[model samples]
Target chain A: MIDIALTEEQRDCLQELINVAMGQASDKLARFLNTFVHLNVPNIELVNFDSLPADFTENYAQQNLSVVSQGFYGNEGIRGESLLIYKVNTLDDVAKILGYEPGEISDNEQLTDISSILTTTFLNGLAELIENQLSYSAPRVVSSATSSLDDHLKQLSFDWDLALKVDISYMVTDYSFDCDMVLLIPGEAVKNIQLVLERILKEY
Target chain B: MDLPQINQFLVKEINVGIIVIDAEAKVKFINQFVLSNTDLATDYQEQSLFNLFPELPEKWLKRKIESVFTLNTPAFTSWEQREYLFKMRHTRPITTENDYMAQNCTLLPMSNNADNQPELLGFIIEDATDVCFYQKQLSQTVEKLEISNRTDSLTKVANRRYWEERLAIEFERAKRHNQPLSLIMFDLDKFKNINDTFGHVAGDTVLIEVAQNVAQNLRQSDLLGRYGGEEFAIILPETDAEGALVLAERIRLGLAMHQIKVDEGTVIATLSLGVICICDDYSQYEEMITRADMALYQSKRDGRNRTTLYQA
Candidate 1:
């Protein structure tokens, strides 16, 4: 990672900005599902692309992941990708909540559809709170092999110098499903994001 | 005024099954095609997609349908993963195998009516069993072809070509791990004399019988191959010179004890053997085989039925 440092205040401010945006998205999702979503404190890390899986999943192995990715381009010259990572095991509680019974037709299609919707809504919400009209592309599904997580991340085709990793964890109320979402911003976009944060700080 | 036939009217009556479920996963409707093909009950209206099918993945169904409701788009799956979404069974013509029918399924989000009713999820199921069956048969045929290429027709053992390839792989592995490796090469003793006196048929019987005897005496890890017309080779991985010689002696003794029957009478045959270990001084795998060859020549010169080991 390029060793650009963030002051303690800057980190705290960025975290707060993300927290508020994600909280709104969570509320919207909760309304749609008719359930509460538990959110964890969003943490930041500086990591290289090659070491992403190892650095990201410090406590977990490469389990089955359904990744929904959306790349948003900002009018303020900041660009980033947001990934909603589902552990796949959470789908059962989700299905039951959706009025599906104990036995039925497969919900594989349903899982992909849900992945796309939740990811897009959550990502677009974050883009809006940043005060930039970030255009989000259609979400794409990546049911990648769990064994070679790094290889799949390497093949992402983005020549990003550094990744500002934002880790978010959420769970559905009364459901066993808990999932992680990540925001990967490039090094060049950091300057633009800081400027945006500065403007918000001056106004507030 | 009569209206022209639209795609919806044809799709409902087509052989494929069409079913619709709501965002709450309750079965909204089942077309005639779906009702006739599967054992789907008529009391499906407002029934949970889970309790109606009772065999499908409930959570997977919810995920797909929920995503459809959220994304307002279509999603798809085929016979490759779970074979069929339904438990409908059918017979395959080629293999005479009776199993679940293979199917390709598409799920599309349906817009609500102008009356402001809730939106529904649409599922189109197409039978794809025949294509799946043929794909399995082709892969089985390709596996048989692969086995044929690696086997020897004469002795029913690994052919020389396969043996050579395996030897190179083992050679590098042994060197890298500092493990012991040995090679044993042997030939039927007085094989030309037996062919001249008793005829070539008797000679052929003796060679077949001897190969089987040697194979029986070998360890499971040892690879036995027909090196040439009358010469056989064994690749012993993680075996020292002494271990190879001991195995070779068992083969030589087994061949001496066994008797083969020709048309005229019974014929007895003996074998000569050589064993050599891979040493640090050796540059390549071929050098180890050469040392075993030198010892084989020594064994034949000393007499016909004994085993010889090259010290250096």
Candidate 2:
């Protein structure tokens, strides 16, 4: 478990690194989608469980389903967590990217299929962003939307008590789609990130 | 917490609806901005989201929130593009100890000094209606301008200026290939007489008809253009003098068979044709065109309703 936290300067460096990594991800996604994609890591926050707002408890007591993937940067020595939250159907973004008239999706089965395709596409793009240094866990598909994402996170067994949340926003060509990419990294990984920066500085 | 202080501090400052619920998914916090912007019920505290935006997928929203608390991971809703004109927004679970403020749903996530769970996942909604509408208009305007520049005003075919620019390059290519370039030139048999007798309007009708007739007879690769008033030209690559003569004869016969009528029962016209094939000795495009003009004059000399080939 990581015990050290990053300084404000270090946090800034982390944000810049994430921006670069996500920018690369955007390029790959753009090529796959046959449109230009843009990625930005706008905000990064360090959070603990009890420090969280009261709404979180009220919302998750009954149902919670989520998918989480663990990736480690061998060179940077930083390990991070990626979560895919699919309580909401992702096809809205897809339809927006298609730039067509809105069509209704009546059945849950159709929503599931669309979500799976979208999740796979996003994960594939995220992998390219990390320069293949990270591998994604197979997405855990579930129907009890409330319990699934949280359940998946529990299965990963990572420390949520000492994690940094990286807030990301990505758009595919002309803001056709705007979505959130939330990455959680352990507090210990922050020290590793500092070391990586030092190494990079030395090399430069 | 003073109610007015909360409302004034909350409204319109952030770009997304702020709905805060305690551990039970009951509305614990509803900012004024959420009340004004979204269609959610105003009496939101302790009220379930299912009771509010019934149209929203409540089960999915609950699942996303639950996952965020459990894994201490921020769960995200898919980008919800507003139907009318608002910006895309999504809700994510934020857990910070000291900051009980709902998710900082601005375009930029708010920074904080919370020691414990500082994962303030903001719900960001941007207004893209104006931007999108203007961008679409810009694209349409560009397409319209492009179309107008390439179309001819009279014949609706590619204009003489475009043809001259394009064919000069083709002529250079033909010279490189050492291939024959044939030209067929035609003029209305008594175009001046028609203008004098019937009026300029009749002359124009006759010219339009002649252009259509010659255009129909030529191959797709062959070029046809109105070289000047009552005069038309055609360029046929890899065609010899004999081939050009045959094509010229076809144009003559085609025009002879087609007649344009004025106001009364009187028929309007016929056309004289001239054919010339470019040889290795022809140094310039102007020279080839001059020879074609001479052949056209010869056609008028021999008789008006037939084609004549340049013999030198």
Provide the TM-score of chain B versus the true chain B for each model in turn: 0.86, 0.58
* Predicted model 2 interface RMSD: 12.9
lDDT at B212, model 1? 85
B122-216 per-residue lDDT for model 1 (tens digits): 88887788878877888899888877887777677778998888889889999999999999999888889889989988888877877788899
For model 2, residues A76-115, the per-residue Cα lDDT tens digits are 5556655433335343564445332345332332343223
- Which candidate number has the best lDDT? 1
Q: lDDT tens digits, residues A2-60, model 1?
A: 54456676677777877787787677667666777776777766666656777756644
The digit string of per-residue lDDT tens for model 2 on B177-226 reads: 98888988888888888888888777777777677777888897898877
RMSD of each: 9.5, 18.4
Chain B only: TM-score of model 1: 0.86
